[model samples]
Target: MPAIGTLVDSFDDNAVDAVLWVDSYGTYSETGGRARVACTDGYSAYASAAAYTLAGSSIYVRVYPPAAGGAATAAYGQVSLLSAVAGTELGVQVNAVSGVLRCQSNVGYWDAAAVEVAYDPVAHAYVRVSEAAGSLVWATSPDGSVWTTRRTLATPGWVTSSTTVQVRLEAHRDSGTADYAEFDNVNTLPASPSGYAARKAGLFLGFF
Candidate 1:
């Protein structure tokens, strides 16, 4: 079968149960219809759920970061694809501290062995990621149509050979200060034809 699965959450449901899992400091009620992750204690916050099992080797999503505000500290919110419940994940994010977009990877809790600085994708930008043909591509767009590739992870370990991973939303704060982020219109839609070269990938599996 071709690689095809869609999980689009407009977050209009106004319920966190719409997702498979709402773990650690992640909530869906604070903003009515968006998934919100807040980490005021200067810790990593995660909001995730099963997205889709890879039928080939391609997956991606378009996410909206929270609008600028709140404590004005160095923080970030991201959308990622995780291979396991607790370890190994890859995705694109925006760092408020550095004022730029980035490609991030995590091996375990509090263990970010890799962090690649990309371009600045100011608040509300359409950020996306796609993996196929042994590569993981990260890009950002002012609009969903025109995109600029920021970074590419070609290493084998960047994305495991395994075909299933969960979609995740994260909020990270620098110091023990109040910071929050909201995600909306999250989906598994490849950035472009070239991004998902091996297969046509785009789908909205379900809210939950």
Candidate 2:
């Protein structure tokens, strides 16, 4: 198997790393080797890292979603790739109540596709977004070794042209008692030699 690259955090220190994350909202902390985000009624909790260029790289996170049966009508945990411009992002979210997994993109407008498979802590735990040659791929995994591609999109010009993009982890609940989501094994993989060649080849392929 290929080695995982560019570890962002394992949360083993029991503290959020300020050097690696910023622009946090609500409660975010490291607990028992996981990054935990507090999900309260009417509010969202999140943190972001704006350290990587979008091309030729991939970002991943393992999410343990919150359970259902609460007063909350809407609750979910998400991992997102955000362009430098606000309101432009690609994200995957797992619904807490229905366990639905939604993959969405926003480049001035929101478009989404969903997977009917409910999230299982052991069987469906990972989400990833990869960029190569002006395209973005979204996928999910059970153990990070095998991945299921969920969506593929032409990279928005705002993203492909940006010098850097952000990776965000977020959790939210609406009109309910407080709950939380756990995030772990945050990491990134740099582009390989073949990926660079693909990018070069894409120059002549014409985007959608």
Candidate 3:
């Protein structure tokens, strides 16, 4: 059986994994639609959390400039996984660049996951959320690269065992200026592989 212990809480309400997050804290550049005040030269800085007791606790972040100027817009950045306070276990942290919740995870599949959100499309420069203002979209990813649509979830599927997974959203833009996004709820969802579409959407059934 899997090890038994506390899984660890990713973050708090205003915390992506912890609370809400955004992109580009400065004014919009004439060329780049957005401009973030990076701690270093485009380096994901460490956010101090004095109260957090998790080992190696750090926040690794990435960005997606508005899809306008820089060719780097298409460059897919690697994910940054982190540890939560649920327990001693370290959850996998993925680099989120397109939606509202950037990245979040739990101890493999033994426990629930905590997610971060970020969606700042130039056309819609706000966090993408459900009508109820939830930050997660219950969907499936094809090999952890692409996600299925919102309506195509299968039933009696998406079991909540070890394989259960969370579908995180990253924000994408068409320009690089004023690109800031916001998120609402960090979700803990199950990934349906069989009944769910590989990267599409439809009716779904399962017990996650």
- Each prediction's Cα RMSD? 9.8, 12.9, 16.5
Clashing pairs for model 2 are none
Give the alpha carbon lDDT tens digit for every residue of 32-141 in model 3. 22222222113232122222222211211223322222323321221222233233122222222333323222345333434433433332222111111222233323
Weakest 10 consecutive residues of candidate 2 by summed lDDT: 1-10
Q: Rank the candidates by lDDT, best first.
A: 2, 1, 3
Residue-level lDDT for 120 in candidate 3: 32
- Per-residue error for 157 in candidate 3, Å, reads 25
Q: What is the lDDT of candidate 1?
A: 0.57
lDDT of 1 by residue, 110-176 (tens): 3354445544445226776666666666666665566777666664452444545666677766564
Q: Which residue window of length 10 is worst by lDDT in model 1?
A: 199-208
The C-alpha stretches of model 3 lying farther than 4 A from their native spots are 1-68, 73-80, 83-178, 188-208
Report the lDDT of model 1 for residue 75.
Answer: 68
Candidate order by decreasing TM-score: 2, 1, 3
lDDT of 3: 0.26
In order, the Cα lDDT scores of the candidates are 0.57, 0.71, 0.26
TM-score, one value per model: 0.66, 0.79, 0.22
lDDT over C-alpha atoms for residue 58 of model 2: 76
